[model samples]
Target: MLQIAVIGAGVFGKNHIRIYRELPGVHLAAVVDPAVTLEDTPVFASVDELLASGIPIDCASVCVPTVAHAQVASQLLRAGIDCLIEKPFAASLAEADQVLALAGQYGRIVQIGHLERFNPAVTATMPILTKPMFFESHRLSVFTPRSLDVDVVLDLMIHDLDIVLTMVNAPVTEVRAVGLPVLSPKVDIANVRLEFATGCVANFTASRVSTERVRKLRYFQPRQYVSLDFARQDLLVIDVADPAAAIAAFTQGAGLQHPSAGLSLRKLPVENGEPLKLEIESFLTSVQTRQEPRVTGQQGRAALELALEINQMIAQHAERAGLL
Candidate 1:
């Protein structure tokens, strides 16, 4: 069994510990968290203490805050331990570089925790994304003080941004964003529009204040419009000849009489299921065989770079609006 250490016992860190404890082929050596304790597992005040114990740890999961990712990852890498750092890999690109460099020098694997890669809706839709022309996504959640330290763009919209870049294989041509601070000094509500060289446009909106939660994506392709409800793991595909046809068809399919005539309609069946375990299994296999992770440090860096650029745009807009 591979020996592993779980750093941090915060809400998220606890989940990691629980998963690690239940997974076969993994020996939970210890859990490190200065602020919390694990009843059955050995508790160390810090990673340094656990490492000094010479407990033969093979890998570790760094579940600390974003600001502490690089520092914690560096310490673990130097100790000859591979790591899976949580999302928003680092506060800045330069810091991500440092952690990635350490991983290369030490020959350790660094997997990013972009959990959406494991979402069933994304997996089922990946095969149908053939030359997407336009994409729109909205991820809204009620205010939670836990993640107020970061802006909503990074805290929420980054998930969709990563998904969009993964689907579109072209370079970004232009970017526009606007944001405002609703409950925190940081951006709590933001919208980003990305234009790619291939003419693919992705518009995304994220908010921390909402009456209900929504995680949805709509993609426009050549002959079909793909709509996914990530929150419910549902997919809907409508086939049509053009945008006008698609809207008319969608309305007609919903039993609404269309005002326009000569509209073609086709309702494609949707596939719904769960695939979160698939991602965890993939991570385990990658760790066991020393293979690259599906969502590597490089992919995480790319998404983060774009997210930061959009955040910058939001900052500029906020400044112009005299809200900053």
Candidate 2:
């Protein structure tokens, strides 16, 4: 059995611990968190204590606060432990680079927790991806005290940013953004527009202060429009039947017989599963095979770079409007 240690027994950490216990061929070796105590599992107050205890840990999940990610990950990597780090990889690029460099020095696998990438809807949409030219994404959540240390862009929007970046596969040529604080001192709502080198355009709106929770992405390609609903694990694709038929329908709008004339609509099948479980399983597979993780540290850094850029743009806009 692979021995696993979970650092940070907070919200996300607890879930990782529980999943490790549930999965076979893996042992929940210990937990490192000063504030938490568990009756069944060994719990240490800090990583230093856990490492000194000689628990024979094979891997660990670093779920500590954003600022501590680098320090904690560096310690574990130097100790020869592979790690799966939680999102917003690090507070800044330097810290992210430090963790990545340590992982490289130690020859350890590093996976970033961009959980939505493992969602059934996203997985289903990957195979059907075309050269998408336009994208519309919205991720909204009701006000919660969790992850208040960062703005809505890092806390929420980073998920979509990672997804879109992966799909577009092009350098971002332009970024324009605006954001504001509502329920928190940091930006609680943001809207961003990104233009890519491939002539693709993406618009994103993320909000933590919302009456309802929504997670959706819709993109339009040459002859297809795909919609993915993250919460429901649903994917919808609409394709034009033919170029001539589509043009005819558009030109003869009043004479069209149906609202969806010359369009073919279908829902893609999604194998629904808990994303966190899948993520942990994938991480274990990587550890066992010594393979690169699906969400590599480099990809995480790319997402972080974009999120930080968007935050900077927001700050600039705030300063211009005298909202800072």
Candidate 3:
């Protein structure tokens, strides 16, 4: 059995703790948090305490604060323990590189917790992707005190960012963004427009102070448009094409705005399940098989890098608008 411990006892960390206990061939070795304690499990004040306690830990989930991610993950990796660090891998690119280098030296599995990639809708939307050119995404949630340390770009939009990066499979050539702080000192809402080297464009809006919760993404490609509801675990694809449209026009304009006489909309089949459960299960599989994870540290860094850039753009816009 693989022995595991959770480094934090916050909302996300508690969820990880619960899921680990339910998965097969894994033991809830310990819960490392001085502020909170879990019954029927040994508790430690910190990773140092957990390491010194002599409990055999095969792996751990680093769900601590963004600032602590690098330090906590670095310690675990150097100790030869595989890790699954929650999203926004680290506070900055330097810290992200630190985690990757540590994992490389230790030859350990490091999975980034970009949970939406495991969402049923996203999984179902992948197979039919063909040069997606335009995208619109909205992720809104009721105001919560959790993850207020960073801006909305990192807290909420990074999930969509990772998925978009994987789908586009191209480098971002330009980014235009704007954001504001609401109900917190940091940016609580943001809107970004990205231009990729492949000529694809994506627009993203994220808000943590919304009155209602929404997690949706819609994109268009040649003769196809897809809508993905992350919360509903549903996918809808619409195919529209002009029979006489030239190959260039079909590849360039492809049903983005106006559909031809022929159009069909249908829902795609989806396998519904908790994304976190799928993520942890995949992490365990990589640990056992010594294979690459679905979301690797480098891929997570790409998302983070873009998110950080968006944060900069937001800051610039804020300063220009005299909101800073």
Candidate 4:
């Protein structure tokens, strides 16, 4: 059985621990957290403590604070442990570089925890990607002081940033952003627009001070318009460019109106599964096969670079508006 250790036991950390425990053929070795304890599983104050205890850990999930990601990941990697570091990769690009270098030196597999990439909606959207031209994304949540160490861009917007980057394989040519701090010292609400060399444009709005939670992304391409609901694991695709296949399906359904007015409407079939569980399973597959992870260190760094750029633009806008 593959032995896995969780490096944090906080909010998201607890979810990781629970998922690891539920999966078969994998042992939840221990949870490394000084502040919290898990029943039946040992808790180590740190990765060093766990290593010193000789628990035979094969891999670990670094779910610690953003600032501590590089440190914890470095230590584990140096000791020949593959790691799945939680989102944003690291607090800064330099730190992300260090984590990448350590993984390279140790020849260990590394997976960045961009959980939404594994979402069923995104999975279903992948096969239909032809030439995306425009995107509109919004991710909003009620105020919480959990990740105040970073701004809303890093806390919430990075998820969409990663998704957009994966979908649009073009170089970014322009960016415009605006953000405001409502509940904390850092930016809690942000709006960003990105233009790519391929003439694709994307608009993103993220907020941690919203009245309700929302996670949705909609995009339009040459002949298709797709909507994804991350919370509901739903994907809706509308195609008006091709009416032949649409009309046939509509006729076969006995005028059921599967397609309306030469428009093909489809709710794509998505294999529903918990994103975190799928992420962990993907990491384990890489570890066992000695292959590259779906979300490589390089892709994580690219996403982080874009997020930092958005933050810079937000700062500039904040300065112009006298919000700083």
Leading candidate by lDDT = 2
Task: Give the winner by TM-score: 1 or 4.
Answer: 4
Better of 2 and 3 by lDDT: 2
Tens digits of per-residue lDDT for model 1 on 1-324?
988888888877877887887778888888889887667788899888998898898888888888988999999999999888888889999999999999999999888888887787788788778999899999999988876667888789988988899999788899999988878988888888999999999999999988889999999988767888888887777665455654666766743235342334433344554343455566677888999998899999998999999988887887898876
Alpha-carbon shift of residue 131 in model 4 (angstroms): 0.3
lDDT of 3 at 65: 93
Error of 2 at 189 (Å): 0.3
Residues 134-236, model 4: lDDT tens digits: 9999999999869888899988999999999999988899999998888898999999999999999999999999999999999998878999999999999
Error of 1 at 189 (Å): 0.7
lDDT (Cα atoms) of all candidates against the true structure:
0.83, 0.95, 0.92, 0.92
- Against the true structure, candidate 4 reaches a TM-score of 0.94
Looking at model 1, residue 106 earns an lDDT score of 95
lDDT agreement of model 2 with the native: 0.95
Clashes of each: 0, 0, 0, 0
Q: Is candidate 2 or candidate 4 better by lDDT?
A: 2
Give the runs in model 4 whose Cα sits over 4 Å from its true position.
242-260
lDDT of 2 by residue, 191-250 (tens): 999999999999999999999999999999998999999999999998876767767777
Which numbered prediction scores highest in TM-score against the true structure? 2
Model 2 lDDT at residue 223:
89
TM-score of 2: 0.96
Q: Which ten residues in a row have the lowest lDDT in candidate 3?
A: 254-263
Tell me the TM-score of model 3. Answer: 0.94
